[model samples]
Target chain A: MKFKAFLTDNGISLLEKRFLPALDKMGKICHLYLTRDHAFFLHNLLNGDGIQSIAQFRKEALFDDYRISSQNEDRIAFAVDLSLLHRALRSVVTIYAEFGADGGAAAVPPSNRLQIKLVKKLPPHSQQAMPFLTFETKGYKSAVIQDVPISKPLSRTDVLELQAALDSAQDLPQTLVQVPDMNQLQTFVDRMKHVGDPISMSISKCGDLHLQISTTLITLGAEFRKLLVIGEKAQVPAEDRNLTAQSRSERAILRGDAMSVQVSVKHFSKSLQCHLAKPDCAFYGIAPQGACLTVIFQFFIPGTHQTDKSISLHCRLPVLDPGSG
Target chain B: MSSEVDAESADLECELDNVQGMVDALSSVRWKRHQDAVIELSEHGIVLVVEESSCVQAKVYLQKELFVRYEYSAQARVRFGVSLGLFVDSLNTFSRPAHSSTIEIRYPGPDMQLLLRSVDSLDACIYAEIRTRIPETISWDYNFEPAGSTPLSFTVKSAALKEAIDDLEWPGSSIQVSLQPAPPVVTFRGEGHGDLQIDFMYYANTDLLTAFHCDREESHRYKYKFLRATTSNIPSSVIKENRGSKLTIGRGGMLKVQHLVSVAKQSNSHSHADSAGYLQPSRIAYIEFFVKPEVDDDNAND
Candidate 1:
């Protein structure tokens, strides 16, 4: 199996500036799954927290050339230390910032190509070695190559499970809530972090959103009215599609009825950190009566009105028991 | 408990065009060792006091006239203690440099929670309700009256004092502030690694020192950490249209630093003169930091 890609400067900067910080919070080890269509970086935290995070980069927007060859039908997956990768990316960004496109080298033209190659190497004594991610570029004076050591690829079963989760989440019963402004919600969650553990969010059919956090000393809540709730539009199985339509219409009938879910305030706030990127528009994909919450931040290329790219952060928090505080 | 509270609950509310000004002031003192603060609401205005390590205290006073609308119960004073971190975080959510957010605060009654609503330039509103507890009544009877006929007091530009404080050498536990009347000079002495002294002669730099008064040579040593907490507000105050920071050395070795901060003015009200039109910023908001001197046995005789 092999995977290679030429990443764009904007794509690499976004990964370094926005995505890496959130991934760092999940775990140090991550699996990079690359395919012709997309590239996914997954981190399943082993801190006994069962926390998993993934960042998906679309092939067209992220890379100039994407290629993958594998014996199996699925994409190729390799595990590597994300911290080391982040450090390498930071150095690349620093060099790019210090020396612009030209770098004042007329003899040797500066290359925008940050070529990434994954290949297997054999050591002096070892019969075989895992694939290493090698980053190379031709600078003004000379060529520089950096090698990042990789670990054993994720087990086939683990990769399948992650892919299944991502696929299943697409057809789940979801209500899209447009976040007109994130500052208020950000502040509300920030304050709730200090006083409570589990935060309950309730969205009514009338587009009223309520976030409540209760402790022994205080029970605070903020109500947001008139948030647009787009009905489920994703393709679902024939039978489930009918059921989803019926439930959505029923919700429309009861204006005050709301679907509420309780999530760890800390985890939810961590997911909200994507707002730091200042995306043009933000929306939440909340599964009905489920602990899984997906926050998608959409960013458009400057000078263009198209929003064809986005970074989605998913969070699965424990549901609080009704009897517990 | 008071009958007037019932009447006030019906219509008691205060509004401000901008919330960033107060957030900046509170942040200056929020870094102290105290995690909580007491907010006292009276007919005069709102007073937030943060007491740190039982040795230092900072108070930000927003007078009644500072608010676009101020209403208080005529019966009794309303006071409560809240987590300073939470309060500051909630207020900061609406703070942006490009645009100022409007804030409306209401204290309905003793039983009801305090309500705060902030609306940003985009018309995004954040409504926060903070629970309050009865503030602990502490005896703060430090007399600030000068001991002699002439008090050791001076008015200095906030930017100048902030720069001097920032330039002081670290690893020093105490900052010795000395005031002299003969030549009108103010000196800051930090004794760490070596003795570092910074003096501002009133005669040499008249623009730096706006006013100076001293009867005798008096010097007081205060914990450098406590004094450092007050310097954070200097930068914000110095950028205001009307900016000046006053330092007064009161009796019992109490240090008081005061700044008059200009808050948001009404966008439509542009008079520029007393008789030309309606005036903006009818009153000024001031934040003061009070620090108690440390009693050092080594310097007691000196």
Candidate 2:
């Protein structure tokens, strides 16, 4: 496999400031899934005990003059230490901010360009070779290169497992609703931390959401009524029109019944860390059978409702046992 | 408790046009260590009180006039206990930062819960039912009588007062708060590893002290931790409203700090007049903190 790409100034800012800081709060390590057209950061995708997070970015939105070739469909997936990667990216961003982007607008000078490549760093002590994601940035008269160690590329089976996980991450229920205010949800979740650990998040088809925590001292709840129901129209299959017509009657029955999932407050709060991205809007939805709760963060064109599809974030928090309720 | 059939008309119900206004008011008294608070609703409004170790007590007064619609038909005052932090958090969930959501608050759910519902959201309804329990008797209600005939009292900018206390945080465990009549100034002195003193001197051009009163020179020592509790929770929003906090040395050197929290819609939206041509957005919440002075330390200082 051979991979090399030059990151745009916009890409450096987005990764260095918004995405990395958000992922840094969730965990130490995440799988970087890179394809010919896109780059995705998969956090805990193959369930452990943490909230599963997937952040996707269109390759064109980030890189320029990109090239990659691999034995497996031009795709590569490997584990990366988020902190290490963030530190490396931040240094490049710092150098650019100090010297590069300001004076030159049209074209990046030869020295100021940021080049990223996949290289093998053969440790002298061991015969086995290790791969690293290398970042090189030049500023003023000085140049800095950072190589972040990465896990070995996933085999075909492992790639298939990750693909399956990504497919399921899209399995959010159709009853997703636009949350009222992020500040409100954040403070509510933060305050409930005092009462108990496991919080029951119930979202109904009627757009009612109740977040509750009960302890011996108090059974506290916050209900949001009449929230705007939102759904991703692109995900629905055209051939499922008959299924949609049939489920319409079933949806009427589901309107009165709220699907409740018990999740650890830590996991729920961890997902809220996406707030750092300053998303234009955030939606809350529950998966079928209360399997997981999905939170989608989207960016919009500042003055208009048009969604900026270049970046997206999805968090699926696993539901704990229902015995607590 | 499910007996009230005409609950909407007979219950203690109130409407707040600005939910963040209420959040800002309650957040002024929220400290991380304290959670349990007593919420009492009467014809006047809601009074939320949280106490720490029976030494530092904070009370938030949401006047009935603050609410756009206040309906209190319950013959007896309704009182309940709730997690102050959780209540503030839940209230937050119902509000959108960009727009003020009209929130309707009602007490005594069928199961003795406090119900909060957002009324302005026609397509989306946001509500929370906070479980309420019988309120415990408040640890000691001070008579708040005048300390002496002259009555030691002073009004200073709340932000300045909080800053003075916060700045003294690094020096020692206890702080000596002294107000002398001759100079018309209030001083906070912290002594330990190093001594730090912050003073608010009343002058014509400065806005520090708006009002002042004193009987001779009064000095009292208060635990730095307890003093911090009184000011740490004063949400910055309240300070932006530009209000004064009054420090009254009540009977026996008990210090009472009073802060005003504007519950009105931000001035940008406050101009909307109701049908009565009387919907005044001049609502203000009264928050008072009473911290008992360290009595033995006072004797030692004397």
Candidate 3:
């Protein structure tokens, strides 16, 4: 059964208005995983003390936790586990947040301030500048700033502090840390080491397609925001190579594509673009201003003169870019 | 026969698609040159194709609090270029404080003996991108006064005063600031014994404005700097909009205060619902002119 696109309340409107069309144009996705945490912040905002709820997510909580904070100003942190996505299932392994939580029920009036952060996996050697995540409310259109990570390699003290904090539920944001689970690492390594034939099969056979993700956000100056993700890797096959491995285990030497994604939004209302490191490796196309897009890719047997596999599909959905005219 | 036609069309389309992809990649990857473009958000580290002829540098600064946290405050410098045209144009067009710019420190201190050349220029108009590794907590206030003296003297009543001062209490005595003729000098002449953080200044010669921001936990005093004639010649607008005037500490915000000055022989009268000329003077008072601490939480967009 195909997994229907499930968008939480907060993220529902955007998906219907923009992202749905983009996904439809791509057409390869058998199942799309719109997350629940995306809507949690808005729910908290409606409840009261929404900002506080978001602030809690900024602390050490589960990746699925909804958080908001208004102590300083209303802020929200929304995370998604792309590993649940059907297309990514066979490629990636575990994907989740380090820590996250709901800010509980609102204890005060709701603030009108709004902020958003989008995080996904990115490998090294990726472009630094990021595309903007733009949105609109009435006449007000704003883009949340994008912050790049300044790699803070964890120190031994940091590890110890995190271990202690995890053992005891105290000093969350400061002490809470997410180390790669050994089992998860081993699974990923094992997959990388196993050589597989080109993943060309009947559409029904591909297993869990998910996008693994992790992100941390920081607002630098008033004019900028930074979203930092650590150790992101998305692998794609190279061109001009025919996969003829007799067994799936024989093709261990092939290297998958590594992508670094940077999304930057300037001012509240301006152009937002994502700069990918290796443009050639990216088969995916981005719409201008991320307008409603229609993508069609024709495929055939790599080096064959025969015609056996044929599939045609069509989908329509809105695009994300509130500032676009 | 029909199948052959289909294959031919498919081959043609694939070839055309490959060529189109090459052209599209070239156009799509055109790099935009950015010297100090304001960071709108946080993503990953930056990577641009560095040209051998073009000198490229990226400089990002945080509020002093954040800079100190990153331990880069001492090393942080304005990104400069070897390109002469860019440098001269920068000095001319971008010299003054713009709406979204910051006023940064140009010198270390009196001891540093440094010039504005080494000082950091702050952008008062634009908020800096900031990320804090520490807990952020902050509050705000602004001083208000008429641009110039009018028929009506602004009063410091309880309510109007509340917005300017946090948790204020009547000093229980009179406070008078005398502007003596020491070549256009304005001193923080006060009599009250309390720890205070006062932002005192002169505006439109008829208002000796001393906005007292109180923190009972710490002893504070309101201090004024005596501006020389040469310095006073510069409009109060320039001073209020001083580049260094804006600083982001933890979470960022904008604050304001009114400028009031009293003309010679013209005493500005005041009453706390009771008309009495009693200036409250502190026994242990310290005064100095300094920039208000700015808490910058601009890291949201990095």
**Model 1 Cα shift for residue A161 (angstroms):** 2.9
The DockQ scores of all candidates, in the order shown, are 0.16, 0.22, 0.07
Rank by lDDT (best first): 2, 1, 3
lDDT of 2: 0.78
Q: Which candidate is the best by lDDT?
A: 2
Give the DockQ ranking, best first. 2, 1, 3
Local accuracy of candidate 3 as per-residue lDDT tens digits, A1-325: 0111211223332233333332322222222111222222111121221111111111112221334332222322222222122222111111111011133223211322222333332436776543222111111122222222222222444334433432332112111112122232222223322121111100000110111111121111111001111232222234212221111102221221111111121100011110000011101112223322211112233365442122111111123232211
Clashes of 1: 0
Report lDDT (CA) for all predictions.
0.66, 0.78, 0.20
- Please report the TM-score between candidate 1 and the true structure: 0.77
TM-score of chain A of 1: 0.78
Give the true-structure RMSD of model 3. Answer: 29.1
lDDT of 2 at B107: 80
Model 2, A261-282: lDDT tens digits are: 7899999888888888778888
Evaluate candidate 2 and give its CAPRI docking class based on DockQ: incorrect
Residue A71's C-alpha lDDT in candidate 2? 89
Candidate maximizing TM-score: 1
Residue A91 miss distance in model 3 (angstroms)? 43
TM-score, one value per model: 0.77, 0.77, 0.16
